[model samples]
Target: MERQLPNFLKNYGSILLLLLGIVVGSIVGGFFPEIVAWLKPLGDIFLNLLFAAVIPLLFFAIASAVANIDGSQKLGRIISTMAGVFLGTVIIAALCTIIVLWFFPVDAPQVAQETADELLQGNPGDTWGDKLVRFVTVDEFYKLLSRENMLAFVIFSFLVGIAAMRSGETGASFRKFLISGNEVMKQLLILIMKIAPIGLGAYFAYQVGTIGPELFGFYAKPLGLYYILGAFYFIVFFSLYAYAAGGKHGVNRFWRNNILPSATAISTCSSIATMPVNLSVAPKMGIPAAVANVVIPLGTTLHKDGSSMSSIVKIYVAFVLIGWDFFDPMTLLTALGITILVSIVAGGIPNGGYIGEMLMISVYGLPTEAIPAVMIIGTLVDPMATLLNATGDNVAAMLVAKFAGARGTLSAADGLNTDDADGTD
Candidate 1:
């Protein structure tokens, strides 16, 4: 029985279990709609568990990685490389989304009056200065806990980490403690994931049961096309990036190892939730923990390849719905700039698509009524967007590691091995 149990788990792990749940939930919701509300808590509990761990995990993981850096110069090089890779990928994704929309355009559907009113109520009338301030600093430390201000946390963590690195002997012991704490949090994440099937199954069941029918309605075609394009981009473009970073063998190993993490991202529809899995699996793909620790956490907040694609699609749809002339060169350029900026500020929080939608209204000078239409599109493509976002982060980590000279092993250049008295590699 014991041996059989292990084999059973191996065959029916979280991915299979979550898929099964989605199927079963869809069936149940389709036939018995009354039960979906009751089943929602199962998924909510699971999501809450993952969310609870995200901030601390990010803090310790990033702080430890930075503290281990040999000096500010190496850190500067890695940061620059990471930023370049992130920008290049986002631009490519944005261009792909634009081209796809150009070929297969969507006519915006009329949104219900109630939905428009509800969406408009949350508009903050934010200015560029307000947005910039929010990204760089927060009014209170506790506000950093909110996912909306995650970049602020990244900045704070970097400062703390840099200070620790310069503290000499005292910093070594603190870094070790952080490493230990990060390991503990990772274990906690694994424990939470153990019941993912049960949690996700219930959640998906409620989702499909409630929204399954709607998915086949008017929103189906454009959303469906977005999913197909997203898949293509993820598989082809992401693989190419990986190959560039790690070579054919490295790319092969990455795809081979990341199947489960990809599935996790799809199911949860969150890059933040999938960070634990990404961090855990990165070392196996030849990314040193030091690099993975920094890249994955920062990427979760800053990288938005998937969101860039979705935002482009949403903006295109909005233009069509409102009869705005998007073909004007200056208008097109402005839209592209706004899309990239939105992606940068979108963060790793769940339901962050709305923030992008708000930007669309403010930046494009669209009617507040357009909010509901943009948000509806966002909801439909969120899973695919998140899958792309999470997968891109891992790929970016590989490229960053490669650029930093990580070659299938840990070394000082890779930032995994620090020059400390303990000789900790």
Candidate 2:
């Protein structure tokens, strides 16, 4: 009986099952939207399970990684590598969007009166220092438990980790606790993922049933351009990055393991929600725990190639609406700079895209009337924006792994959990 089992099942059973679930859900939702609308909660239940487990998991994983660091020098190298890769990718994404907009050119659509009037007032006058303080810290420690404050938690975890490492025998004992907690979290996640195929399918069904038709709405033309551009960037550029990180093997591993995170991002439409999936997928992709834990969490808040790309398109669309020149040299340069900043600030909090749009408006001195157009643009682009934002974190981790040469129970070469020598995944 055992001999009848196939090796392909052993290697790829979960992935195939997952793909099947997505397809089935998408098809049913497409053809019979009313029937599948209620299944959304099933998906939410699955996301909630992972979210509950991940709060502590993120703490232990990140704190333990820092606690176990051999020296500050190596930690600096890891951090430096992470920052360099983030900056490089954000720049590339921004430049790509700028170049594409220059050629294709988004003309403003005649937005509906309701949309232009629907926008709420935003306080765009907040200074950079003010934004930084709020983003990096919360008034109370308990606030860190919220997923929206993930960046603050990242900072806290690093401090606690360093303190544990510095505290002699007591600290060493604490470090063990952190490591054990991290392992427990990983196991908990593996068990949670047993239901992923079903959960993700249900979620995809909800997404397609509820939201798919909106893509063909009044804003379809500009939305279409951004969607096509986002897709092209997601596939072509990410593949190039993977190849650069580890050649064909890197590309193969990245593609195989990334589907879950990509799906989760599209379904949940939040980078923070997808972090756990990325954490689980990272190990299976051979990302060192240190690199995976840090980069993914930080990337959840700090790295946003999709958001950056979308910001440029929003700028172009808003400028067009306001009767401003889209390509004035100094003004274009400012928009490019805003793309990087908006990517960071817009994603740092929940529902922050609204604030990002306001920032763009304030910076460009656009009339409040332009708000509705960009707001709609943001709404339409969010799912794909999130996919790129979340999955690109894993890609950045791979590049950091290549640059930093992280060593532990796993090696990039070991591709330990990545799979057999047959492939990196």
Candidate 3:
């Protein structure tokens, strides 16, 4: 049992982490509440470092991808495919949030008004007009790029890369600089990678130390539910979508070919970190360079089905905990909008969700402290989300490969030659 357990657990780190988080969160919440305060700082430190790497990683990745496109720009096809997957994922996430709300129903147990009041009292914010003013200022614009607000950073990088590509010698030098910056960030990320396990462990320990055993009930089943929902959406719905968009072999070949990268993404829990593996595996999977180059990096920041799942689940938790009704169409629409917007905005930035949540808390007037609780639930399910996201990306890559008319090989899924299939969409 001991030897077998190791193998089983090795293939199931996400599940193990969920169990660890629950048992630990519960024990800590119940018995050692006092110590949670001390450990909280460690968790904060971990988040800070995690976020610090997000912007630079995104900047170089976007710049590098934009600089490498070949042939007549099939930009339209690429955008459409990405948009389809993204919108579909968002819709599915909204469904997940609603289901979670229906099942859990946070309002059944009334939360104290005093608790809500206390949270708001401590966290102040500007009015809408003030915020708009701040957002429009030139200083804020630069800060947005610097802060790694991925949407801005992506736009900035793409524009810069396109301009540089057009500028001949000067552009070549600029591209080199961006490439060099990316390499430097890569090295920094590698250093951070060594400590990731420690950070994960410390964050887990801190969460476990604070949340008592009773809270274990929250993660045990809901966590599993979220993972299964994410898998169903990607493996079933999105896979079918791939077949419709490209061909049967598109989904199958993509999945089988990129399984290693998918698994690496799940294990590492950092999609950005998994780029080398993804890039290396894409060609072997028969994906074209043009498609693979643009799709994967953009997908890492833009196409986050995993984070989408988290946003959906968290929205449901918010409504349920606040005792709001999910059956209301307005409520569902609000959740959907927030999930998509947050997914896009946050997916762009390095630790986009972390910052995005602050905006959410202020905008929606939800309990800010509850952010930690939502993260606890989301992080537990993140690995599964990553697997789903990686799978979706490969599927998209295959579709894009077909459209690009690049060197194609027989898809591993059904032994069909995509290049010879002769398809027009």
| Pairs with steric clashes in candidate 2 | 418-425
Best by TM-score: 3
Candidate 2 per-residue lDDT, tens place, 1-425, comes to 67435744643465567667767887878888997768877777876675576567667866886687665335688889888998889989988887887887654434422244434334589887886676679899998886556556657887898888788776887888998987787677668767866777787676567555442343556678788989999999999988887788778878888888887787667798889889987866667788887888878877899888888888887776545667888777777777766666555444456556655665555664455457556766888889999999999998888888786412346445444423123
- lDDT comparing candidate 3 with the true structure: 0.59
Which residue pairs does candidate 1 place in steric collision?
A: 25-205, 29-209
Give lDDT tens digits, candidate 3, residues 154-199: 4666676677667776577777887788777767755654444444
Predicted structure with the largest lDDT when compared to the true one: 2
lDDT of 2 at 167: 82
Q: Candidate 3: which stretches are off by over 4 Å?
A: 1-29, 48-114, 121-168, 186-212, 246-302, 314-375, 397-425
Which is the better candidate, 1 or 2, if ranked by lDDT?
2
TM-score for each model: 0.57, 0.58, 0.62
| Superposition error at 278 for model 2 (Å) | 0.3
Worst 10 residues of 3 by lDDT: 107-116
Please give, for residues 241-304, the per-residue lDDT of candidate 1 as tens digits: 8788756766665786688678778766678878888887777677777678778888987788
- Residue runs of model 1 more than 4 Å from their true location after superposition: 1-74, 108-218, 407-425
Error of 1 at 246 (Å): 1.9
Lowest summed-lDDT stretch of 10 residues in model 2? 416-425
> What's the ranking of the predictions by TM-score, best on top?
3, 2, 1
- For model 1, where is the 10-residue window of minimal lDDT? 416-425
RMSD of each: 10.0, 11.1, 6.9
